[model samples]
Target: MSLRWRLNLLIAGLNLGFLLVLAWLLVNNHRESIREEIEAAHRVTVQMLGTAAQTSSVFGPPDTVMVAFLQSVGRVRANEIRLIGTDGRLLFGSPPSEYKAGRTAPAWFAELMRPTLDATVIALPGARVEVVPDPSRAILDAWDRMVLIVLVGIGFVALLHTALLYALRHLLQPTEADARRLVATTRELAQNREVTRLIHAGVEDERKRLARELHDELGQSVTAIRLVAATIERGGALPVSQGAARIDAIAASMYDSVHRIVRELRPAALEQQDLRAALLDMAREWQLHHPAIEFEMHLEGDLADLGEEPTLAVFRSVQEALTNVAKHAAARQVALAVVRGDAGLDVAISDDGRAGAASLGGSGRGLGGMRERIMALGGRLEAGELPDGGFRVAIHVPMPEGAP
Candidate 1:
């Protein structure tokens, strides 16, 4: 259920799967090696029987020799040597197969050993000799060796299990530590962001109050000054008229300055229009400040019904991004896109500039405010350089229910 346990299980499963594969390969290889060794032993046994056949021929009537040789072979329970004419009567050779009652290996063991032997019959002076494996002693020999190997394999597997357990714990220990560190870092970041959010909210409230005071109080006073100056200019001496005109001009300039302040405090475009118009207005205004930059914008789908927080977050995010590009990127070309999808709104602002440069804003460079604003609105923001070239700022804000 917990992440650490799930991760450990995943890693352990993979390691165990690898061990099982190795065991399968080792078992198959061991089985093959045993089979080859058995074949080699059979060849050696068959060769020995052929040599006895040749040695027995040295005698005039070798039947006695053959009988002695086969009887000796039976005692060893290795190879069966037999002699019989066309009549199928026992002429002169080893005893019957009843000699091997309890001496044989179990049937399962025999089949597993699976000796591949064939009878090599030779023509002699009087009768024929058949050379075939007796198989009891040979199979028992192989079974004993195989059992030793099985026990060793079992011990090896146990050793491997212990080593793997230690190794997994050792290898994953740092990773687990790093994960815990990361979780702590993320928690701290969230707390800091909450504090920043509160600070920004208070600062924004102050900005609104200042803008209102400048607009209502200072603006009314300036308007009254302009009215009095105009009246004085209308019916006065020439010098007084010129002085009043200059006074009226200063009043007008001050009013325009205050209006600009109010507009920056609470963006008028966002107030008067929806997200689409607001974003375009922000981009167009930015372009005015940087006439050298070739800026482009693409707005897709309907975005009018996106509510207060979403619209404000999107507009402010773009506004900040373009400002960064204009001030730092030295970029000649830039593009902005806002897409409305079934999931949410997606915004990307990018510039074709020297990427990875100091000006690309590794220090968060005012984009930190943008990120905090987006995150507070249930959106995500990513700012980095594109692989091919240039820097990009991308944001995705999920659409709430009943959103247009």
Candidate 2:
């Protein structure tokens, strides 16, 4: 069931339980009250008849005087009186009660409320007087009162349930609006991630094209220039040879610069689809350039089969982190670790740098880009200042299904 219906059911159950308990209490109280009322009335009637029986002998013959007295007294409330003669013939009986005379409470209600009381008997000289307790009228009164209370209680509980339902609907309105807004936000975020992933793919494709062009076109052209200069140097003319040597050296330098740019655009290790080898190559190059700083790397698990997208995302994140460390951290030591487990791949790059050095500089954009890249790969990236005066970047990328 929906939450609203579940809440409604719960409230209904509670109200129903309350009504049952209220009815039970009302029945118990009324039953006891009726019992007490009948008992008291019955006691008074018995006493009066017994006293009258004792004094009847003074008036005349006991049975005749008692019958005359009973006729004079007529009906007593909540009690029945009868006189028996010496020959076992009925001499007198109390008249039936006229108060609610023709009506009685339901049989079930009467049985529940009926009190147990002993019939009182008084012996006369030639007969006997019997006073039996009667509680029907009292029970009928209690039943009437209980019916009224139950009707009122049911109405009150129904009204209470209606009010609570209204209040719950009113309270849930804002929650419904918030849920819609959350759904919209989630959709927008997913679209943005898709766009980011497409953009990253396009950029990598462009880089690969540029690297291939520079290597095939510009690199070969530079080699041709070097060959021509070598031919001129073989001529053995001092001035021409010197000029050719300078040209050769410049072409050689330009060739080296082009190769470096191509490597940066698309590393050979990545072209071979080996992320571990790419990371190691990058680290070795970084250490070569920044010989003053200490660089460390640790790799575990099978990095070769992580697919191009995740491998590229991790590679770019580490690359950006290391560049940021070189430019901003000014630290003595840097450590990079990449591990793959059953869940996914994890990469961490940390540097022992000045506190908050990475964030203080223009590193936010780079870090943000790296985070977006990782997120697009169904992963997450976290970069922050470490507690002991350093900076760290951590990235995780989930493995695609059936990946080795």
Candidate 3:
């Protein structure tokens, strides 16, 4: 349920409970009041009749005089007076009350409010008087009063509920505004990711072009210089031959350096879109150069078919991590692992180097760029110091939907 409805229900329940408790209290109070009133009226009626009976017995026929007196007294409030003869026949009975005579409260309500009282019997010379308590009028009064109270209580609760709902709606307006702002922010983030992806593609294209230029232009030029210098060294005088030989050696070194830079700029394996091959080749190159540091790599699942974007993201992230490790992590061991699962790709690169050596704390452009690339592919990158004085970089890239 929504917050509004839940709170509304809560308030409604509380109001209902309050109404019930109020009714209960009112019923009890009215019941007690009716009991006291009826008891008092019965006592007064009995005492007066008894006194009249004693006076009639002294001066005249007690039964006749008492009946005459009762007739004069008429119906009593909340009491019924009856004179019974020796043959068990009622000689006189009080008349029914005229106030609310035809109507009575419901049985359930009357039972709830009715008070218990015993009849008072007084002996006469040849007859008897019986006073029975009646509480119908009082019960009817309580019922009418209760009906009014309930109506009022219900109205008040309804107004309170409406007021609370209006106030809650006003208070929750900010939450709706926040929801709108969140949606806008999410759209902006998606746009930013698209921009980052485009930038990455442009960067890769530029790298490919630079690598081609260096390999074709600079590399061929250096090779041609080496050929010309070799020719001069074979035919010139001893001093001239020595100079040509030096030039040929320098040209050869330049050629080799150009080829290395070309390879670094655009690896052949990446050109084939084979992430596994690229990672293996890069690890082999690192192991060859840094033989003193033990380099370990573990590969799992098929990584050759990943789309170009995610493949590049994972490869560059690992490449930057390894570069950092070599430059700062003066450790004896490094491990790199990549796994393709049902849901996505996972990569972990760890080095048993001094903690805090690689500056993975968002201070370096290398790590920041890596994060951008990974995030563009809807992936995450985490770099932190291990518990045992080492650093680890973990990356996760979700598999694109509907891809094999």
**Per the 3 Å backbone cut-off, how many clashing residue pairs does candidate 2 have?**
0
Output the number of the lDDT-best candidate.
Answer: 3
lDDT of 2 by residue, 1-404 (tens): 98899999999999999999998898888878877888898889888988998899999998999898999999998888889887888899888888988999999989988888888888889998888888888888888888898899899999999999999988876786799999999999997886676568657865786878777767776776766666676774446766667677767777776777667667998977799998988888889889988998999999996888887888888988898889888899999999999889999999998755424432455776777778878898887888888988888899977898
**Which of candidates 2 and 3 is the stronger one according to TM-score?**
3
Ranking by lDDT: 3, 2, 1
Error of 1 at 304 (Å): 1.3
List of clashing residue pairs for candidate 3: none
Candidate 1 TM-score versus the reference = 0.44
Comparing 2 and 3 by lDDT, which wins?
3
Over 1-404, each residue of candidate 1 has an lDDT whose tens digit, in order, gives 96556766775676567666765665456456656665565577667766877889786566667766766666324556667755676765555555435566667777765556676787666667776665665566656666676677666766776676677667766687798999999999997976677667757866786878777757766776766666676765446766667677767777776776666556676775488877766676677778999999899989786888888888878877887787667788999999999989999999987665554443453576677678888888888887877889999999887866
* Over 4 Å off, model 3: 175-180, 207-404
Please give the CA lDDT of all the candidate structures.
0.72, 0.84, 0.85
